[model samples]
Target: MKPSIPPPPTQEDEALIKDYLLHRMLQTVLERDIQIFKTLELTMTNLYILNLQHIIKRMSDPYWTVKHQIRQRGIRIESKSWTPEGEIQVLYLCRGYQRSLLCSWPPMKEELKDRIISYLGTDLAAY
Candidate 1:
């Protein structure tokens, strides 16, 4: 028996893949999971899109290209909203950086925490 081999990616496809890989790396850093390097050896994709140091350059001012703007990657962003109780802080992290809305506020904070746990199946974790 022979193992299946993936077809070679075209130039255009390669470009798209590169762009995605870059964005993914940026996203991971935004999530604040600086421990990605420890798990790189276990992943299938060798692109190493899990490093903060590599993508940190993209977030730090004076480097972001028009294509990988902060708003575009959905990583490293903060928002404040006022509820009847107090202020609510909505933070979007890039660690793994799953581009989902992670909560850390008065109301949304607890809800977001629960949401993250439900999706990732971990409890009491944050960056």
Candidate 2:
């Protein structure tokens, strides 16, 4: 006797999967960005100056390569017929926000950045 193959997902199932994946992806991207920002705050400050553009430029290759790998994984998931659209749009949105957060001059609001830096300073000092 031959082994049975599972039935293809229904349209509803596909839509649910896509939505869930998009939500998870967005959450992951936000978490990663926060971590990156914290790391930069801890490492990139000199006196009172923070050259975020230079830091982002130096970090872009590895950052984008990881994102590309994530997209490739999504493609692989699509090939497996799990999610129909593969959440590519969600990835693009996440990428846009990442650029806005890291590549923009002065990056984010000074108060928010200062809060992050202060949190990091205290956190590291605890170690």
**What CA RMSD would candidate 1 show?**
18.1
Error of 1 at 19 (Å): 27
Which lDDT tens digits does candidate 2 get at residues 1-127?
Answer: 9977544334433344343443343345445665566656554444223333334344456456544554533322322122343313322222122211111213223433443444334464556
Q: Which residue pairs collide in model 2, if any?
A: none
lDDT of 1 by residue, 1-127 (tens): 9976544323433233233333443445445554554455665433434333444553444234533544353344434334554543233344223222322334434543443344344565564
Q: Judge candidate 2 at residue 121 and give its lDDT.
A: 47
Using all chains and alpha carbons, the TM-scores for the candidates as numbered come to 0.23, 0.28
Q: What is the C-alpha RMSD of each candidate to the true structure, in Å?
A: 18.1, 13.8
Residue-level error in angstroms, candidate 1, position 126:
19
Model 2: which ten-residue window has the lowest total lDDT?
Answer: 95-104
Off by over 4 Å in 1: 1-30, 35-104, 122-127
